[model samples]
Target: MTFLLLVLAIASEVTATVSLKLSEGFTKLVPSIIVVAGYGGAFFFLSQTLKRGMSIGVAYGVWSAIGVAAVATIGALFLDESLTAVQMGGIVLVIVGVLALELGAAH
Candidate 1:
């Protein structure tokens, strides 16, 4: 359940980040609203996960890493953004680092 909440938080954060690009420096009203609401939902769910006893370090590390990768993928797939091989390698490194953190926390 806590992990689910964390995943929701990461998803909401990534959505908001994508919406931020669409907001055009807040000129667009609808995307701006989505940015605000999405971030709010993300933080709220993140707090819930923390309250449910997930460690702040592990949860935040995973959340940020996954969120970055997800948003980058979204941009590449839907927004016609360039995702170079180097960036893909970096994303893989981030995932590996997160896995290391999770594994370390298990001890």
Candidate 2:
């Protein structure tokens, strides 16, 4: 359950971040609303996951890394942003680091 909540939080955060770019410095109304609500809900669920058994450092690290990667991917795919090879490699590294942290926490 905690893991599920963490995943949801990560997804919500990613969505919020992507929508933020669309908000155009808050000049746009609808995307701005999504950004606000999405972040609020994401944090609420993240807090709940922390209250469960997940360590703060681990949970936050994983959530942030995943959120960044997801947001970058969305930007590249939907916004037609170019993701250079180096950027893709960096994202892979972030995923690997998160996996390493999860494995370390398991033991």
Candidate 3:
């Protein structure tokens, strides 16, 4: 349940980030609304995860890592953005580090 909430938070954050780019410095209408709502949803869901007792260290680490990777992938796929091999490797490392954090947590 907690992890599910975290996933929601991650999705919301990613949506907000992508919409942020579309917002064109808040010059657009619909995407700007999405940016505001998406961020609001992200924080709301993230807070729910914390309230459900997920550790902040683990949750935030995973949230941020996954969000970065997803956003980068989306950017590359649809926004003409590019990811270098080095950047890809860094994404993998971030994910691995987050996994390590999760695994090393006290059970």
Off by over 4 Å in 1: none
Candidate 3 — what's its lDDT? Answer: 0.97
Candidate 2 C-alpha error for residue 63, in Å: 0.9
lDDT of 2 by residue, 1-107 (tens): 99999999998898889889999999999999999999998999899999998998789989988888888888898999989999999999988888888899989
Number of backbone collisions per candidate: 0, 0, 0
Which is the winner by lDDT between candidate 2 and candidate 3?
Answer: 3
TM-score, per-candidate, Cα-based = 0.97, 0.94, 0.97
Which of 1 and 2 is the better model by TM-score? 1
**Model 3 deviation from native, Cα RMSD in Å:** 0.8
RMSD (Å) per prediction: 0.7, 1.0, 0.8
For residues 38-90, write the lDDT of model 3, one tens digit per residue: 99999999999999999999999999999999999999999999999999999
What order do you get sorting by lDDT, best first?
Answer: 3, 1, 2
CA lDDT, candidate 3, residue 94? 98
> lDDT per model, in order?
0.95, 0.91, 0.97
* Worst ten in a row by lDDT for model 2: 64-73
Please list the residue runs of candidate 2 whose C-alpha ends up more than 4 Å from where it truly belongs after superposition: none
